[model samples]
Target: MQEFIPHRKCVGCMSIKPKKELLRIVRTDKGIFIDSKQKMPGRGAYICKDLECLKLAMKKKGLEKSLKVNISKDFYEKLEEFLKKLAVKSFDAEVWE
Candidate 1:
């Protein structure tokens, strides 16, 4: 089998990082969701495992810009809520789903 080292771009900072170094957020047929495992089927975007990165993505409208879809404030609120519940540490690893 060929060795694979996947690279994905951080939606917040637009920096390319190793897949394991970032988190995946996806919008699927069911609904908008976080894909922590990065194995879900959907249009996925990578992000840093930091709230500030999320905030940057939001403030820059990076998600909508990249996803090519409209996202409402409710979606942002939901993401914030989920993140709060997860109690993510500053440098802890995470997968959104």
Candidate 2:
């Protein structure tokens, strides 16, 4: 038997990629969250880890359309900052490795 790898489409770039390669964002009764664990129970959307993709999604309103909710401006700014930190951490990890 072969192992199965799930795939998801990035709302930003609109490219299909393996689920593990994308970042999962979910919206629940509480609020929106960056689901690093990918186990949050709610309406979830995926996007590439790249900042450019994030911008594209915002520009195209892809995330909003897919999640079926209006995202606030502050939320987008916060998300962008989060992604920047993530990028820095990942880059450091790669360098150390």
Candidate 3:
């Protein structure tokens, strides 16, 4: 059987790419934040998983508009740190599966 790939649009560039190629920003009961685990329940907006897209989202306040909530600088800082960590984990030699 052929495999199916999931593609999603990047709010920044409006380009459709495989799901794994994008980063997920979510707003949940705990408040808005980044969800690298992809298992969080809430409203989510996707970016290209690149710094450029992340920057554009910030510059235009795309996420805030999309989620219809204010995103604090503290949230941005924590999410930025997580994105960096995700980038590092992406290249990790170990497999969780």
Q: Write the per-residue lDDT of candidate 1 for residues 2-69, one digit (tens) a residue.
A: 98999988889888999977877788887767777777898887778667888999999888887777
Off by over 4 Å in 2: 90-97
Worst 10 residues of 2 by lDDT: 88-97
lDDT tens per residue, model 2, 29-48: 98887887788899999999
Compared with the true structure, all predictions reach lDDT values of 0.77, 0.84, 0.75
Task: Give the runs in model 1 whose Cα sits over 4 Å from its true position.
Answer: 1-3, 84-97
Please tell me which predicted candidate would have the highest lDDT against the true structure.
2
Model 2 error, position 10 (Å):
0.4
Reference-based lDDT, residue 3, model 1: 86
lDDT of 1 at 40: 80
lDDT, candidate 3, 1-97, per-residue tens:
9999988788777789988788778898888867676667999888876767777778888788888899898877775665676678565312211
Model 3 segments beyond 4 Å from truth?
Answer: 89-97
